[model samples]
Each structure stands twice: as structure tokens, then as C-alpha cells.
Target: MSEHHEHRHPHGHEEHTQDVRAHRGHGPGRRFARWRHRLRHAVTPHTHDSSDKVDGALESSARGMRALWVSLAVLGVTAAAQAGIVVLSGSVALLGDTVHNAADALTAVPLGVAFVLGRRAASRRFTYGYGRAEDLAGIVIVLTIAASAVFAGWTAVNRLLDPRDMDHVGVVAAAAVVGFLGNEWVARYRIRVGRRIGSAALVADGLHARTDGFTSLAVLLSAAGAAIGWRYADPIVGLLITAAILLVLRDAAGEVFRRVMDAVDPALLGRAEDALRRVRGVREVGELRMRWIGHRLRAEVALVVDADLTVRQAHDIAVDAEHALLHAVPKLTAALVHADPAPAADGPDPHLALAHHMTA
Candidate 1:
């Protein structure tokens, strides 16, 4: 039996070119038709094709970069405000919160660099492009979080050893509120964009921002206790903030590690299998696998087809199956479909010799 392979990189530019030609006709209704087409394309989900995939990847990277810059600006302003309060009130809790905000803002630097690198085209040396840079950025972010936690913990311990009065309690409380508002806003924006773009690193950064917001609230509690004449409350709240940072660090680290290990959701595998099975002329769906390359997904599938079918027929079936998978699986940019001829019911296994040789 012969094996047939269908490798397709779908391109939709021809359709786009035709559309442009159609719009070139000078009729009043032509403008309306063109506008309608544009509206439909904008509102509809994008078809899985090479052109669209490239465009989507670039657009997603641009959006991620924007999110990082906007977050950095907001957090920078918030941290500066909190830093002033820290100096005036000498509140350990406020100081720790400020440190966290500053570290969170700086993390965007590495992520932005990764996004830029991810945009580079695939070369002979790096066949998959620079998408893995995002994973490296994630590691850096994890380390930054760990460092902030240690610094916060040490500062809190030192404060506990030598209790001190905090001045400008009202200003410190106001700064804490500002920090919370800024971090929450940045967190929401980052997480929303990250999920849409399928970026794990961006999502982890968003989680970090959210934890910083909660820690900022802890700073407010410290300010309140100080106002009420509890000298130990500030240091205790600082320690609590440190604990919260550690918790977020664990979560962020786990998420990044999963991405690095190419761990995809099991549901995606099921969906891919179901899509392949639904394709006409597919006798059976064999080994199906998917892995993430940055924010996009790639799949490899083995398909069983009729043994008597011509090579061209089997190839067509494989093409159809690949199209179905691209349509059904979200974020899947490419797929390799291999069609195998099914063995006859009364005949020896076609692959037995190959399997035996491999074992030997």
C-alpha cells in the first residue's frame, strides 16, 4: 500500500484581489457592495488561511505591545505616587506595595522585547521563528516576582524588629487606593488582550498585576491600624503583602511552565479528533497531536483512508480533513495530514514489517 500526504498552506489573497477588482467598477451601487463586503469580513470570524494567520499574528503582537506600554505607563505613575507616600509616612507596608508596583511595571520591558522578536519571520536556523522568546520573557517575569517577594519579606522583618511610627496616615491611605485602582485597570486590560491573543505570558503578567492590587489594599489596612495607634500593624501587613506576592508568583510560574512544556488543553485534542472524524472519506482518525508555538497552535494527524482509493483521492480527503481542522480548532495556524491505506480484513498487516524492523 502507498501512503499519500496532503500539505496545504491556504492563501486567500486571490479572493481579496478579486474583491478589489470588483470594487474598481464605477457604479453607485459598487461602493455600497464594497462597504458591505468590508463589514461582513470585519464582523465574521477569520477563515483559517496562511494570509489571515500571518496578519492575525502580526496584529496580535501589536496589541500585546500596546497593552504592555499602556500598563507600564499606568503602573509607573502609580508607583511614583506611592513612593512619595512611602517616604513621607515611612510605612513598611506602603513601601513593599510600591516596590511590587515598580517591579510589575518593569516586567513589561522583557515582554515587549519578546513581542518584537516574535514578529520576525522564520529562517533556516529558526524554522519556527522567535516565538519562544515569549517563554523566556515569562521566566524573567517569574524571577522578578520572586525577587520582589524576598525584598518585601526582608523589609517587613526589619520593620518588625524595630517598630516605628508612620506619619501622614491619610496620604498613605490615599496612595494605596490609587495603587489599587491603577493595578486593577491594567490587570483587566492585559488579561483580556492576552486571552484573545492566546498569550500565556501576558496572562501571567495580568495575574501579577491583580495580586499587586490586593497587596495595595493591604497597605490601606496598615494605614488604618497605624491611625488607631497599633505600632506593629504596618509590619504585619507588610508580611501579609509578601505572602500574597509569593502566592501570585507560584501561579504565574506554573502557567509559564505549562506553556514551556507545550501542555495544551485536552479539550483541544478532542475537538481536533472530532473534526477529523467528521471529514468525508476518512476511515479512521489515527494519532492526532497538537502543540503550541507561542500563541498559535500546530497539529499533526494520521488519517486512515480506503486502501483501493487512488493517491489523488486520498490526498483530496486529507486536504478536506486539514481544512476542517483549521476551521474547528481555535488558534491553529497549520496542520500536517498523513493518509494511510487501511489494511484488508483477511490480509496481513501492511505495516507489520516496518514495525518489526523498528523494534529490532
Candidate 2:
């Protein structure tokens, strides 16, 4: 996603405070204004160029696409190898793995496209940019992995209920070894690229590759067990592998769904709240709300500052609060700091007092 940053100057901090007062908008705009105000005052102009960031993201995206191609190729080769082993060994579990490998290949195409799209800029209508595409692609990958696991588990259950004679275990074991090595290579490369680009889609692709390696290891052990005279061991090992896949699926599904629904990470919210509370003039944080807009975190924070301070002082404190939240929580893209005056010498403001009582 594209990130916007404003110039900050210490002497012009007062001007920024006035501009924030003139802004009257919803949570998004107010949050943007708060960030702009703080950023416009806290730091001076820089001489360093930003072309490196753009180049790095693009290079990462390209690497992810290349890794996807390699994964796809390996999947096809592994699937063919498994098919040959299944035919020679007459093993239902091996046949199921063949199908799973083929399915993994199918997912690589869309995931590659998603990674590329995630690098693009946002249009006027799509202000958040294309980061959500990566999240959506991750969801698709998780679903496919879940389906493969369930299907493999079902096949293993049926095979366990009805025993069959399996042969050529050595061939199946050799194929599984090859698949494991291939998957390892893809997983390592894709994971590095994903982290570099900060692309969830590429990360999901890497996870899929790692899963393939585990699946291969399980299948290899099962083949060896079948050769060693424990006919039931093959299906048992297959079931165990399937169970592992299901566990990964559960976590991936929950994370992707949360992102899609704009859910805020609890740890991030807690950090933001803590930082704002620690600001110089802030007495407490009230009405704290936060969510994910694309890959960026946005927050709305209502805070109580000293009423004795001037408006400019309160605004400066609010700016500090916003800065604290953003700096303390790296993922927080924007924050809206609403400065509430504390109680007067005689008593609290009547409206604030009534609102506090109602809230309490």
C-alpha cells in the first residue's frame, strides 16, 4: 500500500495546530489530519530520497512472482512422480497426495497475480490502495489447504476401513524425498521475498510450500511403514499429516477473516492506548476505537488534558499523543486525538460530568 508522509518543522508547529482545528470530518479524515499535524511539526525536512523504498517493494514483488513459478513447476513434477508411485504401489494415500500437489499448483497462479497487484497504487475511488488483494489471496490459499487436508483425511479413513496390498514402497519414498527438497527450496525463497515486500499473499504462498514439505515427510514415513509390514501405519500417518494441515488452516482462516472484517489487533490497540496515556498532558484515554483499513491501522482516541492550558497547548499535547501512538505502534498508519478539557477549579464541565456519569 502507498503511504503518505508530510514535512515536519519545529518552528511551524503552531501553524499545524491551527490547521487541525479547521478540519471537521469523520474518523478517517480527522485521523489523517492528526497525523499530518504531528508529522508536520516533529521533524525537519530530509535530504534522503525515497526511491529506494519503491524499488525494494517492486523487487520483492518480482521475486515473489519468480518463486511462484518455481513452486508451480515443482508441484507439477511432484504430482507426476506421486502418480507414478501410486500406480506402482497401489497406495490410496499416495494418490491423495498426488491430487493435493496438483491443487497446490492451481493456487500459485492467482497468488502470483495478487502479489503483483498489491504493489500497485490506489486510485481516487480506492484510496486505501491494493493491499487488500494480498489478504484476499491469503484467504484463498488457506481455503485450498483446508480442502486438501479434508480430502486427504477422508481418503485415509476409507483406506483404513478397507485394507489393501501395497507394493513398490521404495519408489514412493524416493519421490517423497524429492518433493520435500523442492518444497524446502520454494519455502525458503518465498518467505524471504514475502517479508521483504510485506505482502501477505507471498507469505501465504511460502506457508503453502512449507506445508508441502511436511506432507512429503509424512508420506515418506507412511511408505516406509507400509514396506515394514504395518499396513495400517500408512493411513495413520496420512491422517496425522492431514490434522497438521487443518491446524494451520484454522489459524490462517482466522487471521485473514479478521483482516477482511477490519478487526484491530488487540496488542496494537493496547500499545497505542498506553502510549497516549503517557503523553505529557493526557489524563486518560476515552472512546478509543481502532481498525484495519487495508494493511494500515487507524485509530480514534478521545483524551482528557489539563483544562487550565490554552487551546494551543492542548492541541500540542494532542499532537504529542498522536505521535506517541504512531511511533510506539509501527503498524498504526493514522490516529485522531480529540483533546477533552479536564474539570475546572470549581468542578467539571456540566456536560462532561453528565456524560461521564452516563458512561459510568
Give the lDDT of residue 351 in candidate 1: 78
- Could you give candidate 1's per-residue lDDT for residues 57-130 as a string of tens digits? 78889999999999999999999998988888786667767987897688898899999999998999999889
Lowest-sum lDDT 10-residue window in model 2: 1-10
True-structure lDDT of candidate 2? 0.67
Choose the strongest candidate by lDDT. 1
Report the number of backbone clashes for model 2. Answer: 1
Model 1 scores worst on lDDT over the 10 consecutive residues at: 11-20
- Name the regions of candidate 1 deviating beyond 4 angstroms: 1-49, 84-96, 346-348, 353-360
Model 2, position 12, has a per-residue lDDT of: 10
Compared with the true structure, what per-residue lDDT tens digits does model 2 show for residues 53-132? 34544565677777778767877777787788777877655666677677686888777777677678768987766767
